[model samples]
Target chain A: MSRVCVPRDAATLAVGADAVAGAIAERGVEVVRTGSRGLVWLEPMIEVETVAGRIAYGPVMAKDLPGLFEADFLNGGEHLLRLGRPEDHPWLAGQTRITFARCGILDPASLDDYRAHGGFKGLERAREIGPAATIAAVTDSGLRGRGGAGFPAGIKWRTVAEAPGETKYIVCNADEGDSGTFADRMIMEGDPFTLLEGMAIAAFAVGASKGYVYSRSEYPHANATFGAAIETARSAGVLSDFDVELRVGAGAYVCGEETALLESLEGKRGQVRAKPPLPAHQGLFGKPTVVNNVLTLATTPWVLAKGGEAYAALGVGRSRGTQPIQLAGNVRYPGVYEAPFGLTLGEIVNDIGGGTASGRPVKAVQCGGPLGAYFPPSLFDTVYDYEAFAARDGLIGHGGVVVFDDTVDMAAQARFAFQFCALESCGKCTPCRIGSVRGAETMQRVMDGVDTEANLALITDLCETLKFGSLCALGGFTPYPVMSAINHWPEDFHVVRDI
Target chain B: MTSLEPWRPERGEEIIAGLTRLDGAVLPMFHALQGAFGHVPKETVAMIAHALNLSRAEVFGALSFYHDFRHEPPGARLVKICRAESCQAMGGEAASRFLLADLGIDWGETTPDGAVTVEPVYCLGLCAVSPAALVDGQPLGRVDGMLLVEAARA
Candidate 1:
């Protein structure tokens, strides 16, 4: 029987991967459901095992099955949809996939497949070298938090390791609520064992035996897939010593923050907490905890498998190792592209992304999440490093790059930045809570051309207050988008200026 | 999955009792109650509070904070449209306006016959294929107003 592969990833399923898989399976062809390759534009992307290698075809729907069978696609024959070999594809070939190495290549639920793909090697190495060496390796690797903050991961692990506590916790912040970002969701759904192995390594390093993955409720598919992977790992004794639990988040974007996530895990409102007693010291039932982003944890195995120095040589500046940049929105070719941290924003949005899908000139690209800044084409020269983005008042937040065409209205987008903050704010601090609503109202007034100059000044003052006074990034960084719009495109605000 | 059992006190108590053993049972209990019944009925506050040995105010506060929990039962079918930036860039606003106008209902409102309820969500992580939506948990990507309406009706 010829072996055929189809993605069971949610993004592919949303576009009819299931139907295509069923269609092929009904024809007596052996079908293996795998995770996405992150080439979402070519999703429902199917591959066939030939003597040569795996041949690819994509964006396939159920209706295309009959014609595909006639064309002998099962044996990698001629077809219009054929993308040839996936690895040779420029998108896949250009990536330096350390964390996502096994993603979309193996069955997520099969322990045998995971191990065959070089999984759990990190945990084994960590065990061999001992906890102190493991921390030293991570610290030497120069891996930082991929989750917006860009904090040093090794420093956090060491803090929890040294903190005086009989019981410590390892919490994976998988609450991926960012709009243009899906790298975390993809990892959880694609290579779950990697995350488990990373968490286990962290547990060994910090004396924590319990782990929790806090994911959003919006991702039912990812949750189910990851849940099964956890069970498979547990039953196979991979997680025998370190117990792991999956906690579903209840539709709170604020919970993506580490401290707020801890509070929510303890069954409280997803509210932000004050700093100083950082999560490393007091978190998740007031115990010392090592809270890291999914990507940060998932990449640990790679840093361990290869020596830390080897990993550190890959990227530029403080950002070491490959960053999985998610190209989304109006981009022509949108997907997850992992590369070293030196790629310029222009190279990412223009060359890799193929510009806007609308066939129009690209106006602005929002880097990071909703909290990230909107960079016009003029600022595309800035590099993708964390500090580089910070210098430009931008954030490589979760590595999401959402593009926009020339038709975009900056004033409305500016207003939306404030509105989003207003809606998702934890209401723990007055600056974020009140500032956001006032900012939105003021931006609307400016757009309405009612005392435009005064309202613009007010928005500027409010953003400053939000930046300094807000407790978490939700408020502090909300000004990135709001102010970037006003500074880059002042004409947008004066569209209906009082005549 | 569309039809749900009517809210019953004994059933609610059983669900609450079963989940109280977990460290943070409130959120899970809310999910279970909503799964069994269409929504987290208003009466579930006191029942969960009593079972978990917490004040009803705390339970209610937790319940109200998250956007997932619903106070009242929804229409037979639910349609969630993405209001986030990625979707917005792909003409989601126009699609959403068409959906709302065609259905004669605004955001977070249900039709008169209670056939379908519409709500706005931040993002569904399907940004590559923008203008995405979820109809009762089935994600649809590269969708338009008509596609959403058809999925809801189906």
Candidate 2:
């Protein structure tokens, strides 16, 4: 029987990959369920082992099974759904493929598969070079946190290493609550061993004996897959003396914040704690902790294996290394496009994304998540680097690019930014808690043509308060979307004014 | 999803006992209790507090802080629709409206017959597929109101 590969990634599974896999297996074929290739639109894409390498057919439903079998697709016969070799596809070919190098290609649960794909090389290298050198390598790599903060990963590790604590912890913030982002989830479900290896290296470097991956409850598939990978790594003794546990977070967006995540891990309410002691100095049960995002930790393995300078060679300016930019929403080719920084927004939203899925003119794109700014097509020339985007009041937060066609309502979207903050505010700070609700009401009055200009002014002032007064990014960043909407698409806000 | 058993103090205690020794066991205990009983029954708050050596106020505060831990039993199946920006760009609001209107109920409300309860979830990381939903914890993407209705009914 020929071996066929199918994605078990949550998005593909949601669209019926299981049924397609079952149908293929019913033909007495060996079906291997792997993670998604990040070519999301062609999900349930099956690859067959052929003399010319793996040939692909995709977006396949269960009903296509009989035809596929009849076409003798086991040997990569020509079919309507055939897309030739997957790597040759423009989408996959254009990507840099650093952190996500082995994602869709390997079976996440198999430590052997991971090893064969250059997995634990980083950990081995870290061990060989010793702890200080390992930390130095990451420091020299110029790698910053991919969790939107853009903080240096090596500095955090060094702080934890130097901090005074008998017991320290490594925490992986896998709580990917961003609306258009799924890179962390993809990595966890597709290449879990990489994350574990990275964590192991971090634990070794920081002198931490325990590590915890704080994941969200919404990611049931990722939690299950990563949990199994943890068991496999433990059994294989790859974790060595370091112990890692997967902790699930209840549905609290605020918990995605580092301090709140530590609070949630401590079995307390998911409330944000003030900074001064920083997580690296005192965190996670009042011990020095290294809290890093999933992407930040996962990228460590590559940084270690390839040498820090090699990893640093790519990406423009300070945003070194590749980012798994998630192209989503109304885009035609919605998938993770792993590339170096400096690609213009226009190129990403147009060339790589293939424009709007609805065949309409693209009006706006929201980078980052709910707290991100909305960029009109006018600012499409902005570069993808963190500092570059920040220069334009935009951010490459988590590298999520959500496209929207002309049919979208920026006024409504602005309102949602407030409403979402109101619904999810941790209630620790008064500005985010009270200001968000007030902002939502004012936006509603504007939408209803009641004192539109005055309400708009009030919103601008309130956004200022929410931006600077809030304790954390939750309230602090909410104004980005609100003000961006008012600035870029002012017509949407003025549509119902004083009629 | 399997049918949830009626809330039992013994079963709750047993679940709590298995995880009480874990560091920060409250959330896991809450999850287990919800798994068995469909929701964290009010009675188990005191039991969890006692077992974990925390105050009832602290336990309730923790429980109430999270949206996942419900205080009441849901319908036979739980249906969560995406209401976040990515989904909205693809007409999630319209689909959500269609489903809610069809069911003659509002968000977070159960159908009259207790067949399904619809809730608003921000995102399920299915933004690429758009208009996604979770029926009894199983994800479905590229959905419309009709599709969600059919899936929830199924």
Candidate 3:
């Protein structure tokens, strides 16, 4: 049997798959492309055969090829470093790779690689059933926008499709601003075609002739990967008929918001726009548009191709299908994990994530992105679904779980949330812009032991106002962290008051 | 090759000539001037303004709007520590403190020796590894006090 080894870097693997195949020649090993083990820290991680098992050494840069052969990596012998079967690793085994099915598995840019691993099978199948069938499939799958909003993907598409407009646009919100969330980045970097295919499906469903992928400037690798993928798709006639453009965002947090993103794409300041005319009604230079998160679009191909019921089979409650949960911060195994939404936060943090890296008990787990609420260890039993999190006054904001240990100060974290809002506020609304700055100051006063009770009360009131009065989520959700910290860890706010 | 003369009349004539060869020359002309000099040099802006028949303020406004366009020269190294929520959640405060102490400069401050300039970036998309920082635009994840010092030193 001839074995073919592809490097973990999807770009290099895409270009080098042919060369590796050519070198193998008549050696005659069946080529099996498997999903990446999610050990990105040891990237370009390649495994070859030996008498014992598959040996792995990594962070294999491009120039290390010659020395690798001399080291007898084909035999799976012990070298300076060698990991046994990659699949056996607890980290890899624990993960449920749904959205990231193609990551580390196929050569990212290769249409052939994508097709081999059931890539466009979804699109091909989608085309057969037509638009209504595609919508039904997605709705059945119960997929939600993975970009932190958690909005139902099927419902959003149906709205855009049903909206009245001569020129409709399909816009992909690739501005991944949340901390601990790299599923979007990984998908783009490891499998750009999936995203493109997903976007194409959205365009077709919404009757949009043009599409745009608004990627953040922070992710240079993602930008390059998507850019190249778009070109490849165009040349291959996948996107030949659609007018698609990749617009790089000029580093703005507020731009992650759907309306704010549209404003930035128009080459204007990244400010949040007042809703009501929501992009569905009038968007992108005054036209009906469908603005979807990267994860939302990426999940589309699967729903369309596999049929809606098949996609919906996973997950529990309002949250359906698989979620690409990001484990970050003090977690021992900080990486991307995909799992059905039924898993408990405790199970994800302790069982899968291996608890805090500091060997301390997890004090709190911040689910979702920056704006997501912090759940105290008491609420560790909280299930990983939208309604479950909402019940506890928390949100599954983009499925990013940042674990914090005992050393963490909740008051400081609360202050940070306010400070972050102050810095990133689009300044279009009063509550978010001014309230954030005032909230930060109040948090500081509480921390400084000045009228601590009053300060705490003021901060909570401020959060309530921001939540109710803001124009967009940037302001609306700023209260999540502040309130969560105050509610969960009351002692952090306790301070000595003097006359 | 085009003439390197800095005179308004000569530069204006050259810009007009360059515009004739290209369909959309306004952006390209601005880019060319910025590319030639480290910053959009005053002389180059004047030349473009004169050539395009636009005021210098109009050119300056456009340049200032873009974060990439810098009027002043940059330091040797650009250290952008993520002050966003994800990084903050990951002991970013301690990391920031360590960096400031080590480098003797706060966020947005360049070192006296011009070795490094520490800036606060909202996010670098390395949220999975919180307390992440980018050195000269290369993202470094799971950054701590030691890593921050090592990166600064390196």
Query: A1-499, model 2: which lDDT tens digit per residue?
Result: 5789999999998899999999888878898888899999888788887888888999899999889888888989989999889999989999999889998888888888999999899999999999999999999999999999999999999999999878999999999999999999999999999999999999999999999999988889999999999998998898899999999998899999999999999999999999987999989999999999999999999999999999889999898888899989999999899999979999999999999999999998999998999999999999899999999998888889999999988888999999999999999999999999999999999898789989999999999999899999999999999999999998998786343
lDDT for each residue of candidate 1 in A146-194, tens digit (9 for 90 to 100)? 8989899999999999999899999999998888999999998888999
Q: What are the DockQ scores of the candidates, in order?
A: 0.84, 0.85, 0.30
Chain A (alone) TM-scores for all candidate structures: 0.99, 0.99, 0.89
lDDT of 3 by residue, A378-426 (tens): 8888988899889988899777888888878898889888988888887
- DockQ: the better of candidates 1 and 2: 2
**Ranking of predictions according to lDDT:** 2, 1, 3
Candidate 2 accuracy as lDDT: 0.92
Give candidate 1 misplaced runs (Cα > 4 Å): A497-499
Clashing pairs in 1: none
Off by over 4 Å in 2: A497-499
lDDT of each: 0.92, 0.92, 0.74
Candidate 2: interface RMSD equals 0.7
